[model samples]
Target: MIDWARVGELVDEIGAEDFEEVVELFLLEVDGAISALEAAAGNAVIVEEQMHFLKGAALNLGFEALAQLCLKGEKAAASGRADVVGLDEVRQIYRSSRLQFERDLPDRLAA
Candidate 1:
């Protein structure tokens, strides 16, 4: 599960204005990379690149589970093992994490 406490602390440290900006940046990067990864299919280079970017972004956001998924994707892609089906699992996790983040953020701020 996502760590709401850490997220709350991060929001408190950054302030609402800065937090919004960072979230926007994160969304842009994640959206773009996910799209590219989907389009690339079996292309190892593209998959690895997208996963690498996602790994870094997730790490920076303190999203440990998402970051770990990205790390696995990166290793798989690096090995030239194109498991397109497995990518869907990663996508699902990403979507779930993102949705949870969005849903919890406002409540955290309100509190």
Candidate 2:
């Protein structure tokens, strides 16, 4: 889920224009990471690396749920259980988070 407070703080610090740019860049980066993650398949090391990167990025943007998922996946992958990560679930969460973020962002920012 999106953290409106964190988003607000970020917007306050960077202004709307820059925040948008950051969000755009973040989405692009995450998309690439997700693609790589999918391609990693059952490679535990690759999954761990990608999940670690994703967790950090998600945390930075206050995508709390996604971050948690990434952390779980990271730990699992670290333990050589990449199959537990379940790419479908991760993709679903990301899509949901993205939809909610896009839907509520403008209103939240205006408020």
Candidate 3:
């Protein structure tokens, strides 16, 4: 299950007035990065670069699960494990996490 208390804490840290806009922007960027990483999985360098970007972005946004997955993908890509299956798994996890984040965002912002 998602940690909504952590989400609330993050929003409070970032300032409630700007929380919604920032969350929306982060989600949009993360979604696009996930797509790019999926499409570039055949190229190890590209995949690694995308994962690195995603890792930092997720971490900064306090998206712990997404950050962890991106770190795992980065490690795998760095070690030359940029296979289709691995990329697909990352994409699926990203999608699931994104959905959960969206579902809980309203409450976080309201707080």
lDDT of 1 by residue, 1-111 (tens): 466676677778998789889888998988888888889877988888888999888876667688888888888888986563367777787889888888877887898
The pairs that clash in candidate 3 are none
Question: How accurate locally, in lDDT, is each candidate?
Answer: 0.81, 0.89, 0.74
Q: Evaluated with TM-score, which candidate comes out highest?
A: 2
Clashing pairs in 1: none
Best lDDT among the predictions, by candidate number: 2
Models sorted by TM-score, best on top: 2, 1, 3
Q: Model 2: per-residue lDDT, tens digit, 12-90?
A: 8998999889999989988998999989978999999999998988887778888999999999999989988788988
For candidate 2, list the clashing residue pairs, or say none: none
In terms of TM-score, how similar is model 1 to the real structure? 0.83
Residue 57, candidate 1: alpha-carbon lDDT: 86
TM-score of each: 0.83, 0.95, 0.76
